[model samples]
Target: MTNSNVFQNLSQESMSLDQVFHNIVRYMKQDVIGNYRLIFGTDSQVHTDHTLFITGIVIHRERKGAWACIRKVKVPRKMTNLHERISYETTLTEEVVSLFSEEMKQQLIDIVLPHIYKGASFTIEGHIDIGSGSRNKTRVFVNEMVSRMESLGLEPKIKPDAVVASSYANRYTK
Candidate 1:
């Protein structure tokens, strides 16, 4: 199949993942602007059991300007049974939850907000690569970033189906 078609198929099968992610992003934004806090942690126990690295990326865009930030969390390799692996993953998830507020603040003041005055149409993108796990963490990270942007009086544009005809494509193709 063509790359575009492959991406389309993948997107369709991942709708539930997308919804969970959106919820996390929304929560992060609310926690930041409303509570003014920061959150962070490592799911070392889970990583030790799962043998995977979970990385999160938050991309905030405004007009022609964008700021991207990445948070790499190592989920320990699986050292025992499924139960142990699950427990570890759960711990890591909790750690991620804790980091939402603080990370959002740093990303906004340090990266995203500065670009706001430079453009109009703003879009904030977030991705999580849970190598061997799921998309839960990635969605959480993105939602947090989006919320922060909103709190700053910016609206976020999250389009999960525009990969083939994306701005990145237009830029490179031109």
Candidate 2:
């Protein structure tokens, strides 16, 4: 057979999203057994000019292969009640900002794990920017997610900060 013909034939076996979902469920069914439930949660928090959002996608694959479903949970940032206390403080100390960021990230990660494949590997990537005076908290959430995934035998890949910088660097060069 010609190379083109070989490529054509191999392409026919490519699995669709539905097929992959089925396979995942079929692969996971035994662990869940008689009682199985899938849940997903996304949480976010906003402190001053900084916003932290985390999204978790969960897929529950069934043993029989036919009963698998995926759920996406998103958490959005909103103003915090503590704003009242910080209202009078003109500038936030590095320690105070760090604590706030860590707390928010933890809250988001705590909600993501229940919906993931028990032993499947996954990664989370995104960007975060805090205005001149604010500390970026998005990194805290990403790091926490990676740590949690590691505990579950899953490896997480976080994109490097240089990638974002390069994108903007190129924008001005040309």
Candidate 3:
């Protein structure tokens, strides 16, 4: 919801949306053109007085390597309900995915749009923090969240499978 770009890379410098897109393009063209997946996901941690949210964009090149950019924001409001909290996390993920998808579309239009899902082989997926295999209360919202993501044309992945959100983003949520 914040207007300013606040994502930071673990190894390099922080990046704006444009920078992220350019980096991905560079990686795709120089490192792995037809073998990579772009993923967007979010996770959150609720404290007594606030909530910390982390949204991550991961670029994974098949058997080669991976890089991710993360944004961490602290909301003054606290989200306590399990369902509400999980829903909020999914919403955050959606926001990031929307922006990312738009940027990537513009960048890849001339490069791979005509050959989408074919020669280029670039993929975009959304990873939700909720999963069916967990004892966590968020499991109940898996179906709803996945359906929403699917409606947006993003392949949805859940915990165990959605390490981008559950594991990576979660690591920085605190």
- Best-fitting candidate, measured by lDDT? 3
Please provide, for model 2 over 17-101, each residue's C-alpha lDDT reduced to its tens digit, 9 standing for 90 to 100: 3444344345444343322322222223354554333222233332322222221111133336433212211011111222223
Which stretches of candidate 1 lie above 4 Å from their native place? 1-50, 62-76, 79-94, 100-174
- What is the lDDT, from 0 to 100, of the residue 121 in candidate 1? 22
TM-score of 1: 0.26
**Each candidate's lDDT (Cα)?**
0.32, 0.29, 0.78
Which residue pairs does candidate 3 place in steric collision?
Answer: none
Per-model TM-score, in order, reads: 0.26, 0.23, 0.86
Worst 10 residues of 3 by lDDT: 108-117
Compared to the true structure, candidate 3 yields what TM-score? 0.86
Q: Residues 52-112, candidate 1: write the lDDT tens digits.
A: 4222222322122222121233333444554443344334434334344556434445432
Q: In what order do the candidates fall by lDDT, top score first?
A: 3, 1, 2
- Model 3, 86-121: lDDT tens per residue? 887887787777776665666654455555556456
- Tell me, by TM-score, which candidate is best: 3
Off by over 4 Å in 2: 1-20, 23-70, 74-136, 161-174
